[model samples]
Target chain A: MATAVAKKKKVRINGCVAAAQAAKYADVDVITAYPIRPYTATMMALAQMVANGELDAEYIVADSEHSQLSIAHGASSSGARVFTGSSGVGVQFAYELYSPISGTRMPVQMMIADRTLDPPGDFGSEHTDALSARDMGWLMGWSCDAQEAFDNHLLGFRIGEDRRVLLPQMVCQDGFFVSHITTDVELPDTGQVQEFLPPYTHPYPLDPRRPVSHGPQIMPEQGPPLQLERARAMEGAVPVIEQAHDEFARIFGRRYDPWLEEFMTDGADVVFFVQGAHAVTARYAIRHMRERGAKVGLVRLKTIRPYPTDRVKDALSKFKVVGVIETNLGLGSVSSGGVLYAEACAALYESPTRPLVVSFMAGMGGEAIVLKEFYWMTNKMLDAQKRGAIEKRTHWVGFEE
Target chain B: MPAIEIQRQMLPMFPSPNQGARFYNPELPETEPFVPGHRTCAGCGPSIQYRMTSKASGDNTILVGPTGCMYVANSSYLCTPYNVPWAHTQIGSSGSFTAGVAAAYEAMIRKGKWKGAFPNIICEAGDGSASDIGLASISGALYRNHDCLIICYDNEQYANTGIQASSRTPYGGMTTFSPPGPTIPEAKKLFPKDLARMMAAGHPHCYVATASVGYPIDLMNKVRKGLNHKGASYLMVYTPCQKGFVYETPRSIDLGRLVVECGLYPIWEWNPEKREFDYSFRPQNMRPVSEYLKLQGRFGHLHAEHIATLQKFANEQWRMMKVELPAALIRAADAKNLVDMASAEAAAAIAETV
Candidate 1:
């Protein structure tokens, strides 16, 4: 076993390269792409890999994101392990396909380097692009850095293609933060990935011999049942996610909590709740605050849907206050803020010692929440604890007096 | 060759029902590829085409439906009518999606991932989806020469959206968006775009043809011929919409025959191997234009002069197909022979109570 494991090579690469490497390592049969912001580099790298004969794949340069997803769906339906990606409005342009792809159970994997949607066409990182597709029955979450992005891409395939959970995945990372930022992403050898993720074999594909209908028109009565099936698949994915992460850790020697990532919250008084790359920054801020005698920590949500509700309740129940750092927009939402605030507060509502949760609209519109903003948010949480209630429903971190 | 010899030699003598009232549904396979019990309206002409198309492809087939009534109305709430592996593609991605499916199958069969005879990959696009939004993608797929069959189920207008005018809608057709008012007597002034002919002319190498629901056997044979072709093939079929045409639901198949019989819809194929047009299809009877028009509400507002103009247009279409016009059709094209609906005193006297 030791010798077998030792035969697998590991090399350090950047996130975009790591994603392309993972796709190559998985021996993807088809790769569809359309150029957009941070995600374009991944396709560009894969295109070169195909040209160099490193990967034997059908590399299709699609006309648009809509075409990209459609091609991916078509290829995957024909029993090819397909890969594609997009960023920002590119994701939205293919919105008509998300439910159809998932409903057909194609198990197509889409890597999204999150970019803010335009009114302003800013090519900066924001969760809104991917977050907007949260309820589309896709297995979606964000990766903090390059290594995690690579592992998540591999794991996404396993979880998505699993017969019990035949759904597409939006394996995402923040634009420029993890998408462009270089990191030491340890690339797993082909043998390791083969052991970690078996080749995709859809039970009912578009095969001539064993034919089956996909994404067929359903009657009204049938709609609820299929939706229930999708819901059950999502709920059923919780155990599969944990099992996948456990298996991934066993194979690659990298451990991660599949749902909630807790940091220094054993005896902390206040915890900053967040997701994505901002969690790494918040970790540094929390450590600095700990040394300065502040009992503030962080709880980073790794998976947004099939949201780790119980884990979140247990992790933050000891804290007196929980501040959700929303890095995306929710223009006319209940909090007059972001969507995570509603989810975080809703999850905590069932807790025994439901902490006084406050939504801090920071890191929004692709503006990274800095250490100073973290400290400021913690002070607000501390004041809420002193006052025994949230001062307001939302707080604009840097803009407010 | 003489006209008599040409007609006698070229036309196949399939026995027509003696009563001229009997409808003959071709003997189809027992296989239910596209089954019944979907949300398509009571008598969907396109659904009829779909059933025929799928039946022709047999069991080893993959169907692609672009965003259209067939995808929406047929697949609503997830209760599928298809017994085979059917996929819904984007309206514009019909050709491209079908291309990918074909490519995947080609690679799979070669690589031994899928072990079987190659499945027939077919795309069914509505006229609105085909002639408009999806035209370029369809052209691209044909240009790429993917092994697939694309059928544009042309129902003249966009029927699923409640009868909006598509590029294939006929001249003076009264759709909701193209309603006739006092100022604009003819609702839609322009004639329908010659889509099938354009496709044939554009992609000469492809097996391009025109079929209608009026001729089910001919349509099915064309479908088989397209699929049997090694590379890409395109077929544009005239499928009448009862709601859109404002005609009786039972007359759906009748209208298909009437359009062709009146020389309004030409049925021909572009033989890619020979680089020639095969005008081998001939309707059972040659009817006057008024016999086809008086049945639909869209043409009800036509004046005598307008009807004569349509008759002239039909004669020209017959001339294009090299079909010699009978003397009656030539005389009908004259405006003096046409009768106004409001001034038909002889017809009114026949219906008088006295």
Candidate 2:
């Protein structure tokens, strides 16, 4: 079979540009932007795309993040595909819109280039920003690289806009590691994107032709059913997400495990559970450790929100030891560490064969989890496995011996 | 990749009530975008303004109700009064959400997706939203020139939250947050913001006007004119609250008229085309501030000096509009020439009893 290299157009670009390209290919009708850190690059790319006649969309530079999300919500409610993005505290600034956009069932897609929350104003990667809104009824996930970020944007729109799951999505990536770092992403043809993602259409939009009232005040008794319906839609999205990914793989020729991505886990006793861009470095560290006859592997989580509870339990049950790498801050959370540890432990607690799970607080304040830190985290997990019991629930990486 | 002939709806302007020798009620659009059977208080001023604005916009419209009296009272318990396509937005998202709807329609029509005339996009924002929290959002929408209308129903204070002082609350207005005290007899010390003029000055390209629910035909015509405008338009309406103002329920329309006649709430249009103020729209007759203030109990706490200050403020507003103040109105600005409200004695007796 001929490789057909001539047909495939590959471009070296950052995650921000990849997201903009995905939006352009998706042919979004409206884009609302408010500049913050690394996420601002995506808006800049989108602005240029609109300026150069490359995309026919209404690009509004909003006054603030709150307005940006509101504009996206309004456009989505009016039956237009909306694309918007923010970072760090900017994501928190628009926190008010998260619940309403989802509860109203507007499939507004927001690209998040994750940055650490402020105090010192660090522009590095941290999952806390997007993770903080985990309970807001949004379909959330993290992409490891520019290519995955591009793929996730298109996939996010398709899944979120699905009739069964008319909810907003947070397509997130690490701030500098993926958002600023350049990588070769194979851009798909317009025809492929068209076949993969249908034009966004809400069941009932704010159209005079139809004349439907949305978000009306309801009686106290009506509140439960509405919330239950939203819950049903969220829980019902699992099947839709799988179907979309299957179609995406068939049309785009690139497959991704919709829930979790397992790498070199064969015959390994200890594994690192990670998310986002840090998985790229974790893979390298695991490969190097495998050469030294160290039985360490990587199990990277792709989706966090309609959290794959069954999948997480099944995957971790196979290993004797699991080291949860949390790149977020949950100050008073369980394990006295990040929130991911609690999710991992809770997911595994129901499993018959529970792995001795330990939380590692690495990548705090947007600092990268270097290969050395990964090795250190692995040693702690190995020690726990060797003793047949864990010393502590969490260990602060790069802080402890 | 083709030429799309976009069609837009142009609502017919209602005739002025004061057009000729006799005042006549102009025939209105039959479509009741804001219907009955809601929780708005009896003779609610904001509700009247909402009814008038939505009636003017007709059925081919989308209303963005921010967190305010219109959204809370009108859409209580999963029931809504809006017969047109309406969506409730955040208090601060008034303009941005409206802009989004406008942008969506523009793109949808241009892309040949929606097959109809462009619908009227209107945002019914409370004074709290227009003057404070949502001010920047409204300004952004106007500056971006989105084809929409943002109407700030100024009921003086935050009437929805049981009467708190907003930036648009009058100087002598007494609210829950600005109660009359030993040190602060005037209650609210600050003057009301010139919201409509601010909209006009900030976004000079937008159609900015001040209307009162008192003049139904004029208010309706202004709504039509705003929809007819190519881009963003702002209308700050004088909507008196029965609960907050402590006025009689049936006197809502009367208070609206009296406020304008007293020269406190100026009625004018900022014409973008000529880049000048259109002061042609005038109240029927001039009245002293006491006549307007005495109708509402919110101003019952005002002393003679406070009344004088308010009158002076109104005089300055009249001067700003280049209107000549009558000699009697000028004399009323002095504290010596005025007396306290008749209820002031009763209020003092009650305070002494407490």
Candidate 2 interface RMSD after superposing interface residues: 5.3
Off by over 4 Å in 1: A1-12, B1-44, B66-83, B88-93, B132-140, B160-162, B197-205, B215-218, B246-254, B270-288, B308-337, B340-354
Model number with the top TM-score: 2
Pairs that collide in candidate 2 are A217-B77, A217-B78, A218-B77, A218-B78, A219-B77
DockQ of 1: 0.29
Global Cα RMSD, each model? 7.3, 3.0
Q: Write the per-residue lDDT of candidate 2 for residues B197-245, one digit (tens) a residue.
A: 8899989999999988888888888999999999999999999888888
Q: All models: lDDT?
A: 0.82, 0.90
Chain A TM value for model 2: 0.98
- Local accuracy of candidate 2 as per-residue lDDT tens digits, A174-230: 999999999999998777887899888888999998888889777789899999999
Cα error, residue B343 of model 1, in Å, equals 9.6
> Which ten-residue region of model 1 chain A has the weakest summed lDDT?
A1-10
